[model samples]
Target: MDFKLTEEQQMLQETAARLVRDAYGFEQREAFCQRETGFSAEFWQQLAELGLTSVPFAEQYGGFAGGGVETLLIMTELGRGLCLEPYLPSVIHAGGLIEQLGSEAQKEALLPRVAAGELQLAVALEEAQSHYQLHDVLTRAEAVEGGWRLNGRKSVVIAGHSAGLILVSARTDGQQHDESGISLFLIDPKSDGVRSRSFPTMDGRKACELYLEDAFVSGAALLGEVGQALPALRYQQGRAVAAQCAEAVGSMEAACTFTLDYLKTRQQFGQVIGKFQALQHRMVDMRIELDQATSMAMLAACVADQPDSVERSRALAAAKFIIVRAARFIADQGIQLHGGIGLTWEYMLSHHAKHLLMVARQFGDDDHHLQAFSALLDVA
Candidate 1:
């Protein structure tokens, strides 16, 4: 497979990199994170105006319809900048779901709004004790007079509180852990019977625990067919995993770059730390791992757009597993090499390190993806 990016892809990468450099300086990033919403509306608008919000959508929705590689290109830059915006949750995950499953009318109504940055969306899928199982849904959606009444709770709904619209996963038939009955619904977050408790995450992002008590939605809210949401969920989730791997690669790159710069400048025993053979070896090791992780990310992006579902899942799981391990190693080495300053609140490395650790657990962690990869292989 070809590894080189196309001309358009290169332009997208350069645009994203320039935008982050100009707008997401370390101090700017920190300020955004400290906000009550944990991100800046203005920054999100800037991204929208820059055509970022439209990257992965179809042209009819005013988007460029760029695929997984484009997503990787954009997210890597976002990760490097420590961007606090909800682009991942709002645009990639939720938008992908809409694109994949929404009816033509649903797409017309929502996709354009999303592209224009007028709407932000989050998916409420994970429930308490579900771990990383996408099919382990306890939320229930029952038919009502005019629509459906949803009841149950969701945990770690990323960007849930800030999203105007939420894509919720619920069981419409079978029991929890059964993929057959799982379904997806679009709900108004501000509607009655919807309660959200928000909190900051370790990585300076926000998430919410959502409680749905008889939350009512019109028939239009159901995405795809009833009891057939699993396939779309898995597809979007695979895209998310690919994006995460790319983001983690970018984070690892930043960590290594900044740590290397610090080593060059930081002196001990009348010599720069970088010149020390032992330290040099460690930095080389970090770089080696970064390269390997990057290769895996590229592979994941390539496979992410595959037509075959099982092939895509296995490839994504492998990439995620590699990325999780490499990101943790790079973050740990970055902090240790930088000494106590690495742990300080004001330092960029601290944020990147923390974000890297968080990325390991996002979507699915190292162990989770490892098992998934192995299971796929067994089935193959």
Candidate 2:
């Protein structure tokens, strides 16, 4: 079977790329990122108008029903422009969680609104201990009179402060690291006793430290069964990482393109530096690595929505390894080739570099994926 994008997918890619390239141009991104909101509400609303927020959902919920492939396509373009939006966390992660694990009623209640960009959300699943391991949750969810009460702090909750809702992972019957009794819950961020404090990140993304003390949520808020959501959560995370790989691919490709263009223009000893045979080889190598990384990321994107656990983990980890390694190499070479200008804000190289760094480490970096790869392979 062919691996190329379908006509619709191509349209999605072109549409998203054009919109960001034109509307969220480099200057606009800088201005928007420096704002207090930390993202562009107008841009996000435009995405919603374009049905991007609804891409991965079904038509019944006003979504185009685009799958993980669509998300990857959109995210890659988003990375190229470094658009300051919370599409991944607010739309992809939160919406995916609701669709895959929420009850039918819950989906009907939350997803349609999310697809419309009416309710911004974040997945507050990462605690101090929830690093790389979904089932390693320490947050406890105890049954109370009207609902469940949460009492743990979630660290590094991306965009948590701006979210209207949060999907919290909690342990009901399981010990700190046990798989049994691990559960996912939906909580209103505006509810009593649920507080979030924002932290500015290196690359301008806003994360939060969430204090969920007596954070009450209804039983209807439980996503999937109490003990059965761990694997699903992990699966969603793999898809998220797959999207990140695509984003990294785009960022690295842009950096490579930027470096190549600079080399072609910057003169050394009265001749363009790109005229050198050695420099030509280096550019070609960077191009090769970027293309390969993008191809691997596309492969992972294609397989991310698969329900088979083994395949999902392997594909995501493999793509991550290829993409992360290539991204680092290409980015470093780009910076070196560009000389000091690469590090200066007057150029876009530094912006792309920071975004690439965050994406490289986001879900799981090289070391994290290496562990996952070993676990999937059953090797020591």
Of the candidates shown, which would achieve the greatest lDDT relative to the real structure?
Answer: 1
Clashes of each: 0, 0
User: What is the TM-score of each predicted model, taking all chains together?
Assistant: 0.98, 0.96
Candidate 1 lDDT: 0.91
Record all residue pairs in model 1 with backbone atoms less than 3 Å apart, i.e. clashing. Answer: none
Residue-pair clash count for candidate 1: 0
Model 1 TM-score is: 0.98
How do the residues 148-213 of candidate 2 rate in per-residue lDDT, one tens digit apiece?
988998888888878888888899886888888888888888899798889877677788999989
**lDDT for 250 (candidate 1):** 84
Task: Say which candidate scores most in TM-score.
Answer: 1
Task: Rate residue 343 of model 1 by lDDT.
Answer: 97
Q: For residues 1-380, write the lDDT of model 1, one tens digit per residue.
A: 56788998999999999999998899988888878888999989999998999999999998998888999999999999888888889898999999989999999999999998999999898988899899998899999999999999999988998999999999999888787998899989899999999999999999999999999999999999999999888888988889888888888999999999999999999989999999999999999999999999998888877775677889899899989999999999999999999999989999999999999998989999999989999888
Number of residue pairs clashing in candidate 2, backbone atoms closer than 3 angstroms, sequence gap of 3 or more or interchain:
0
